[model samples]
Target: MRVVTFCDIDESVIDSKHTIENFQSGCSGEAQIAILDINSIFDFEENKHEACADKFTTIAIVEDDSDYDAFKNFGIDAWIKADDFSDINELINLIEKRLFS
Candidate 1:
């Protein structure tokens, strides 16, 4: 499976088994999953996340518990709390469940 990160993120959060790509201006491609950092893209263009949801399984990284609830209804497939961001194992497990289950 291929994953795309919509903002500048710590690359190590993803496992090496899956192909990973970073989004850039004017970039075009397909991805099984798209990860977004809330701090970076929460206030992005309206409907941007909706458009992503149509094309890829979308996951959001949030600052804390409050963030989780705040972004819950925004059309994302899943979320990762801030404390879990650096744990690759957790990231992998969450992504797997969201993508495959």
Candidate 2:
């Protein structure tokens, strides 16, 4: 599946395993997985739904638990507590799980 990241995630780890792409702006076309930060949500608040209203899943990387409520309001499918992930593989594993679940 195609995985697009809009945050600080490094794509080199999964470059050969999955379709990991880095984007400077919001998702436009078919997006299988989108890794976004809080800023991306608020920055694109006006068109958040229209951009990701399809089968694509948005995974927010947050610094605080309170952010979850705000992200939920925007229809976030899954979330990762910023400080919780120890490495790229762990994060990717969660992303995969969220994609299929």
RMSD of each: 3.5, 3.5
lDDT of each: 0.64, 0.65
Per-residue alpha-carbon lDDT of candidate 1 for residues 1-101, written as tens digits (9 for 90 to 100): 56767777777767777777766542235566777776645543343543343456667887776777666767767677666778744665666776666
Residue 51 deviation, candidate 2, in Å? 6.7
- Clashes per candidate, residues 3 or more apart or on different chains: 0, 0
Regions of model 1 farther than 4 Å from truth: 25-28, 42-55, 88-101
Candidate 2 residue spans exceeding 4 A from truth: 13-15, 25-28, 43-53, 86-101
**Model 2 whole-model lDDT (C-alpha atoms):** 0.65
- Which residue pairs overlap in candidate 1's backbone? none
State, as a TM-score between 0 and 1, how close model 1 is to the true structure: 0.66
